[model samples]
Target: MIRRKVVLHFPREKVDKPIVSKLVRDYNLDFNILKASITPKEEGLLVMEITGEDEDYRRGVDYLEACGVEVQPLSQDVARNDERCTHCGACLAVCPTRALYLDGESMEVVFDREECVACELCVKVCPPRAMEIKY
Candidate 1:
């Protein structure tokens, strides 16, 4: 199975559609929604991790784009600057995904980029301003 994080932008008209469910039923992709801001009749955004076979993943992405959903990889959204970080572990509290954690042996902050869903919770709580989100 392949797992990848992606952000989906839905137009106002598409807000109420059952689009995500279709990805599973039609394209055979499993999805985990990390964060979402969706209101009927308003533009919507969803951050999710999709898992599937290589061919199914490609087909699901293409299907979303064809239906007017803008799909972007998670790398474009969040980043951490190691040089500016103090490893204070402040970000760990607010992280919903447990992406930020302290090393048991060293008591240093450790960030796992792959597990990050780009929710930006760490960005607000970081004392040294290490977390950054790109709009």
Candidate 2:
């Protein structure tokens, strides 16, 4: 079964708890709250993972959109220039998804794109601007 996932960024005040609850009650979907370091005080973001038919994914997306939540497709682009990386592991420390790792033996940067949420934390934290996120 294919699982479709969406990440939504919303202002804490705008998140319709009732709507979200309704969706969970109506459809068997998984919802995760991601705390944002930048906006620590507010309800940062919502990561919704739904596994079902393609139509169900579409409906979920549409429903979330109708509820005024801005939905975006998650991408994986944590470390772009691994070759040029100085193995500082600076990006690894700030990676939101733990996508960047430093090999203990070589100290080389290892990027797991699948685990990347494309939050751009690594890009912002890297001093050399080694991590570039396209989206």
Predicted model with the maximum lDDT: 1
| RMSD values, in order shown | 2.1, 4.6
Error of 1 at 95 (Å): 1.1
Q: What CA RMSD would candidate 2 show?
A: 4.6
At residue 95, what lDDT does model 1 achieve?
Answer: 88
- Residue pairs with clashing backbones, model 1: none
What is candidate 2's lDDT per residue for 1-135, written digit by digit as tens? 446456777667664355666555665555554433226466547665556556656777788788777877665444488666777888766776677887888878888876666677777677877778674
Candidate 2 structure, TM-score to reference: 0.62
| lDDT score, candidate 2 | 0.66
Worst ten in a row by lDDT for model 1: 73-82
TM-score of each: 0.84, 0.62
Off by over 4 Å in 2: 3-17, 35-59, 65-70, 75-79, 104-106
